[model samples]
Target: MGRWVCRLGPALLLALTAVLAIRPDWNEQLFLLGHQSARLLPAVFWRLVSVFGDWKTVIALLFPLAWQQPQRLPALLAGTALAILLALLLKGGFAVPRPPLVLPVGTVQLLDALPGNGSFPSGHAMASALLATAWSAHPKVGRWGAGSLAMVAGLVALSRLAIGVHWPLDVLAGALVGWGVMRLALRHAAPQGWPEEVAQRLLALLSAVLLLAVVFTAVKDWPRHHEEYWLRLVIGTGVALGGLLRFRR
Candidate 1:
């Protein structure tokens, strides 16, 4: 079971990437499946479920994992950064319209306000899957943790479909980018020669600061629609401050 679980993440991600690359049109089929299935889903449930993939939620989830294992922080941060960067580049280069913009008017019911950007390769899916892969990096996280994280990432990907925001291919491709980046990070960027306890303490302090930034950003009168801004601030500020403190310790 453990062995299979270890292989599953890479296998699943690779499969999704390959299939999407081979048949991009298949996205419509999956989109329809989610679109029709979500018709009866409660508004409140979908809204709450969708939050699992939000940047704030991603930070909330990743921080704890990094705090517990500081050596894992580098991989986690690298995976997340790489996934998001790739997703952003793809979204811009593709300039694919979201369902609300492309679908016939009134065809799909949207649970949230429409975003004003290109939609291919959902950022929500990318971030959630990246964090999921990061968590899977540790053997101690175990099968149960991996399974739970997979479920969460699955739900987050599906939520974009459920809310009629992203096409199925966008979510699938985003997940591929996320998992692939994480795998790369684990392979080449794993922290070396760091004592676990010391790493944990340093990482924990840095995570606490990110949490505070999240809180401050949320309550402030900033443009909530500019989600990327908040994400950049959290990651950028955290890194800038963490670098200074981490080197000193």
Candidate 2:
């Protein structure tokens, strides 16, 4: 996986870079096309898709999986940390402007509030891809399952563009870096940091924290993000409780 990802990286990066540089407005035109096309899907659909990009949603899905395969945590966590560090460093280095800042007002189809800058590569896109890749390694998943996860990762990355926050270049780069980093991490996964039992306890504690955060967010945002309100309340509680119950057993 690592070798394949590394081999694919340069070619993919070069192609995307060439496309972006072919014309001054090429990136902008692509962004506009993606943003406009998003209107074909219901706003609620886009919003729901974007929800998967949120950390809580990802965690809610991963914690139980990680519990079942504690050894996988080292690679998953390492990949997450590495990808985040790279994304943050690049964001600071490039300091690219977000679509909202560059595009005219009312151009972005916003699902929620957005930040003003540091948009070289999207953190959300990277995170979703990395997590989805880790998820595909579960023992029961088949080839089709892996493909579905890949599509989910792509959609998560694309949602950043559909909602008009990130440029197409940003999404493309993020998704690639995400999958690449996960592949590298999985191939070189460090020895498990904790005993399986200990890891379960720690994961449960972390899930408890995530549950609290979900509740806070649901309350803080109220009717404005009602879907998330119910989602957080339900999934957050369920995942956290599942982890806790598993720990108890």
Candidate 3:
């Protein structure tokens, strides 16, 4: 499974790139299609699911998960960090306009203001894919667990479209970028005993910090008044607490 992803994921990325370059307008139709499909689901469901894709959620999950399985932590961080850097550079360089800007007014179902970022590759999609891929690869996880996480990741990507924030191409490219990077990075994720304890303890500390962040965000800051925001607060707080407890023992 991992072997196939390692090879084919990047190939699919390149293929998508070519398609975008050759028939740029093609994405418009796909975006419309994806957006339409997303609306078939309840808006509330997508709103909640979308929160799981946020980078804050990823951080909340990653540290504790790493404490559980120490070997993969380094490569997982490397892949995510690399994916973030690439997404930033590409988003800024391409400066692709978002769905709200491109489509006419009232064409999108906006949950929040489109502010402070160019749209191309969806950052939420990237983060979701990276974390999902990492979780799916966990040695302790079975096939069903892996498949479920992958499905959730797919929904998270779709939620970006449902909320009218991202184009189909943006989510697609972001998913590919993250999945491909993490899958390849796992080649170096083999376990090494004795030496990883320090890293594990640091991961525990990071988990505690993330727990505090979630708590503070949920309480002091005025909630963003959206379903996604509240959902993130609740889910993040829970996950952070769970991670902390796992490391504490």
Candidate 4:
């Protein structure tokens, strides 16, 4: 299973990257969907999905599950951490402007700032893929769980394009990075018992609730200011640290 993941993951990434890079029409279609009329139903759905699509939210949900299988936690964390770090680095290096900031389009119902940073790889997409891949290894969840997560990851990748924040190719690259990271994590870790599993699930639920709270607050005050960013950072960091502490035990 591990070997298959290693072999197939890269191939999938490369294929996705190629499609995104070459297909301008696909991007145009995605952009068209962002129009007010087109976005009527989808906008609402994606926004709702975004709650789970967000990396922090998913992490909060998934981490506790990973914890029950302590052996799996490191790989999961490492994959997710690497994806975040890589996205940050790429954002700094590429500094691609988001659609609302650069593209001449109709009113985009932006959920958050099209951050003035790299748009090469959608971090949310990558993180989702990584989680899906890592979770694939568990006996309890197996392929079905992994596939469900991957499907969600794909939706997130599309959401980025639909909102015109990222090029289709960016989401593709993210998927690759995410899948690769998951494969690496799984190779090194595996889950353990029911108590730990329950703990992980509870933690995920709490994290999701907290994330939704923050997002709801932030959205209510759109065009988030520096203060909001700081608050989110602080709260998110605190949550992560708390989880780490719990994991250590």
Model 1, residue 187: C-alpha shift (Å): 2.1
Candidate 4, superposed: residue stretches over 4 Å from native? 1-10, 22-42, 107-112, 189-249
**lDDT by residue (tens digit), candidate 4, 1-249:** 444444575687698678756886765455556434436555555554544446766675565555556556656666777778888888788776666765565556665456567777788678767766666666777555555666777777776765557766677787888777777666754434235565565555555565566667567656645333444445565665566556443
Worst 10 residues of 3 by lDDT: 188-197
Per-residue lDDT value at 55 in model 1: 62
Against the unseen true structure, what C-alpha lDDT does each candidate score?
0.72, 0.76, 0.76, 0.63
Query: In what order do the candidates fall by lDDT, top score first?
Result: 3, 2, 1, 4
Model 1 worst lDDT window (10 residues): 221-230
Of the two candidates 1 and 3, the one with more favorable lDDT, higher being better, is 3
Evaluate candidate 1 by giving its C-alpha RMSD to the native, one decimal.
5.2
How many backbone clashes can be found in candidate 3?
Answer: 0
TM-score of 1: 0.78
Flag clash pairs in model 4: 60-204, 61-204, 64-200, 65-200, 68-196, 69-191, 69-192
Give per-residue CA lDDT, model 1, range 1-249, as digits (tens).
434645776577678767866785776677877877987877556666666677656766676566556777777767777776787788889999897776678878887777888888888888888777778777787878887887788888888888888988788777777777888887777666258766666565665666576657666726553334455555645653554455454
lDDT by residue for model 2 over 128-200, one digit each (tens)?
7777778777767766676677677768777788877888888777877877888888778774546877777
Candidate 1: clashing pairs of residues: none
TM-score, candidate 3, is: 0.85
